[model samples]
Target: MPNTESLNVAVVGTGYVGLGTAVMLAYLGHHVTGIDIDERKIEMLRRGELPIYEPGLADLLHASESRLTWTSDYAAAIPEADVIIVCVGTPPLPNGHPNLRYIAEAARSVAQNLNGKFQVIVNKSTVPVGTGDWVTRILEDNAPDYHANRYAVVSNPEFLREGTALHDSLYPDRIVLGSASQEGIERLRQLYRRLLEQDFTPPEGVPRPAGLARPQFVTTSLNSAEMIKYAANAFLALKISFANEIAGLCERVDADIEEVVHGIGHDQRIGHRFLVAGAGWGGSCFAKDTAALISTGAEYDYDMPILQAAVDVNRHQRQLVVSKLQRHLHRLQGKRVAVLGLAFKPNTDDLRDAPAHDCITRLMELGAQVVVHDPVAMEQARREWSHLSYQEASSAYDAVRGADAVILMTEWQEYHDLDWEQAVASMRRRLVIDTRNVLRQLPSDTVLEQIGRRRVQETHALPMLPVGASSVHV
Candidate 1:
């Protein structure tokens, strides 16, 4: 069993990262105060209501209710805390650089509320490299003289996926800590002792992995730590783009992408994880982080052709959806097209950079009558995409009713389990575009299309081995 004492932790920003971190820390027996500037969000949290949607988060919050506090007042939460975690938003600007205004404001608030007690300020927000140093300067300039040495800054980037954020937090692949202050690092390490040792019982829904003894404890310089977050996200985006490129080639060559991916993925160096060819990746991280990295490169007079190509390919992929529609229907004008799934990915209502928006925009521009549906993100989409003129469907089946063509933009389980036969019966036409390649079966007369795959008419069988020949013989 791990030996540790509960400490008071103040988490700034009650968004996805902040809420998940605060809840996880509280679950580990720490007294955590979740601070956000938005009064409505704070009030909702205080009333035991979640401001955002994430699987297993509400239950975890309920489980850790005794140790958790919610407030908008920084002074009320920061002064008595032993550790302060900054998890504010660093949204992207038009030029691709991350706007650090929120980070600066959070730092100033932390500085203004500093107490005599020594505290470690952790940067849990995904900022550009050298942000930790910038945050340190901000705190120092704004903090009172008497508390000059009372706090230390550390860069601790987050790697939580939105849909499964709680599970990712409690069972991370690794925990990265980057700081110059040894004392600060030690205190942060102790704060995560239960996680480091994997001593606590796993939460009810988030079962521990089969052999996840402990997560790696990666220590590095503050700049390296920040770079790690950007690099990791950029690489994952590249992998997906690469797969999409291969899928394009496979279509031209009349080869199945699924078979090709499976054959190459078996090799040790090329494991099958994000090798999926789909509509394209869209979330809070990939596009923003890759753009930030490219922007950082441009600042240093550097050109990254590969990363630029990834971005270009992703944009083209979204446009390709419209192109495919035009190819099949000859023209989109007056055609009723149904789009299934609005969120970037399934299980979360985050529509930031969602491909569905781009596809819908193009379809509408070409005069197609568009209708859309998502299990959980319709309200979010209605709010953010209010300007777009489109019909909203109450269910996937309803979306397809009387539609000329259906595009499955997101791979939700609900879409996968949809009864294609029944759905096709309601459609004006029997055309389906499976961007995610998730549909199991369709009517025999229905026309099905997918990315990186084409219908082949002929099948060639391998030569049979001799009766007495060894199967392994070359």
Candidate 2:
């Protein structure tokens, strides 16, 4: 068995998952080498600069700098690693299945550098269920001289949110390890013993959660571990979609959704975590994982109607922003529509499958001049959305000034503390579509539209669409 006191850990990939894992492991007293093919990212990490925006990550990274190393060469790191963690991105393909090209490449590279030392290969990426077996096969095929006893493959999926990744890593709800080999599981258990036992000093700004003395260390078959990740994300997405669906019905029935959710949330079984109604659930995890789960079921000839409907409802939620705009402006043609928020959520600059992207695209298609702003994602938005025709505002107020209508897509604290009275005074048409229902202390006369909440102006008639705009839908 390898020494658990201070193991040599090689974490592949420097994306959100990989970087967070490396930093956390380093803080836990492991000598971690973070390997990635991206030279620029590795160079940045070497200079103590973060490539991504995650709360408390940079501080934790700095604190763990002594035990951390960054490099682009896998051969330099993998051979000496007692634990090799594959945290590469498995982005979803057009057909809703995750493209495992990165996983395969990482596996092949790890296999080729075995160095006759027994190592445990851990899959921390969210991938398809059978990937553990596939990775094991690849390792066996690549390392001809080494026997099967030389290495073991394990599935250790991560459950992390972007903004709170450090906190999640330091004090996760549980630590799950799945492998056929008991030895592989035991190695990981020892590696995570400090976290599992809550024995380490809590990092500054990321204190241990209340009543969380120790987190469960769950172990299961490899397939079950992989499915656990997908199922957990899909269920969370479903909860958000369910809340949105009920929010729609609440509006139709003239009942307030906030009161309804609050009333039901009081029940012990249904706590009020993901029950808030909003523009929709948008992030890297929910949509991709839910789609992948549905695709997995289809491969086995199993139908997943609930998961499909969740996706359909989320897509329709984005379109509701445009529909609300049309209701106020009567037409989108030549209108100055300000989209307040570019990132999928508050706190991070991730725009993968963001609702704002869909809304802006539909608005542009309908001839509206879209001006967008996010607290931190503007640079990233410019990089990713340069081809799209839209103006980037320097601030939220800049985006809203003289705009015909404002759509609050993200609930940033800055947006919440916005000068609503002044914002309404500057707007040519004093209408604000609060998609997140988070805008507070609004001017009573200013037109405020919200999802699942009664509108400021109750109009039952549908507004007329602009010419050629009827074809545009999110």
Candidate 3:
């Protein structure tokens, strides 16, 4: 087990990634200090308010308030930390490469603030393969003195999903660390000893480790570790887009994607995850990381044709959803549309490259009045898309009230059990677009058409169209 009695961890960048790591480490009995540039954000943290939406995160923060400290003081955080984890965002550039300015800046600060003993600087952010070497060089360049052995750099990329980030962090499927030096590897092993040891079970009744010898600690080289994150995300992104592409094929052949996904997911070769056929993958990780991987391929004079196609398909999938909406209604013009969810996927309030953004923007461009309802994404959506005219509704039915059509964009749990009768009654026209393929059952065809209602099933749908498609009644 980790000697958690007196370990100080400084987490730079207090966004979702940073906050998640800091709070989790604190929960694991480490003295964690979160450093960010935003004073207002720091104040919010001080008040126990988390800016982002991640289930079990706020409660984790509250539970570990005594062990976790929030601050904007870079100097103080760095000097006091024995292990500095860089959990900052590495946003994609216009040319589809990761912008490493934040990573470099954080590394420089950590290097400049070096004080007592040797520290392990863990790169918990998804970065390019050579980033470990780059961070090492950057830190060495900015060191207080030329003490080469003062600090060690290790790449320990995070693999937390936005919605269940807390759970993923605390009980990760695998913890990968890449380091050149023995000391750096040992330090990370010590920091993650609890998880490595697998002392705690995965919550109550949450399925124990399957066919595994407890939880083995996997350590690898820095390049492999960095490559692992990109490769993993890229493959998952490919799977999502691949499933979506298959979903389109299924729709064309009148095959139910749900049944197909269920069948395919049962195959041991294709484990069930990221296979939901809907508006393609989104949020901070998949897009940026895939693009970064492609960029890396470009730099090496190699091509990632399959990954490139996956990215293309994901982008095109958003447009496909918009066309499906337009088809459900004859035209989006003069239509009052309700978008039920905004976040990329459910259980989180992250709207980065969300399909809802594309769907809403396209609908508005075609002259539709859009009202949106999400259990937790309203505030973030308001901030991110202030210019879009949308009435925030308390419930899904409220959002669908007086709407020509309602589009289920993100598949939130509340949208799962929608009151079909109320929804049909509230809508001026009963045209529904089920993009996520989440509709379980509907009223009989006669009852639905009698109510002038039609449900647009997202199956074998064509790509990039100008509306006008066949719809199923009920």
Tens digits of per-residue lDDT for model 3, 1-474: 134354899999998889988987787778999999999999999999988888778777887799888889888789878899998888999988998999998898888898858899999898888899999998878878746677888888788888878767766778888988789888877778776666654443233456545345668989999999999999999999988888777766756677777888999999788877777888888889899988888998999999999999898888886676655565778878888899988999999988899888888888988889999988898889997877788888788777777788887878878767556555666566777766656533211110011323233332322232222435
Q: TM-score: which is higher, 2 or 3?
A: 2
Off by over 4 Å in 3: 1-5, 200-213, 445-474
**Candidate 1 RMSD computed on C-alpha atoms after optimal superposition onto the true structure:** 7.6
lDDT of 1 by residue, 378-431 (tens): 988878999899998888888988888899999999988887777877777667
TM-scores for every predicted model: 0.94, 0.95, 0.90
lDDT of 2 by residue, 93-128 (tens): 999999999999999998998788779999999999
lDDT of 1: 0.88
Clashing pairs in 3: 251-459, 251-460, 252-460
Reference-based TM-score, model 1: 0.94
The models' CA-based lDDT, in order, is 0.88, 0.88, 0.79
**In each prediction, how many residue pairs overlap at the backbone (N, C-alpha, C within less than 3 A)?**
0, 0, 3
Q: After superposing candidate 1, which stretches have Cα over 4 Å from the reference?
A: 1-4, 146-148, 456-474
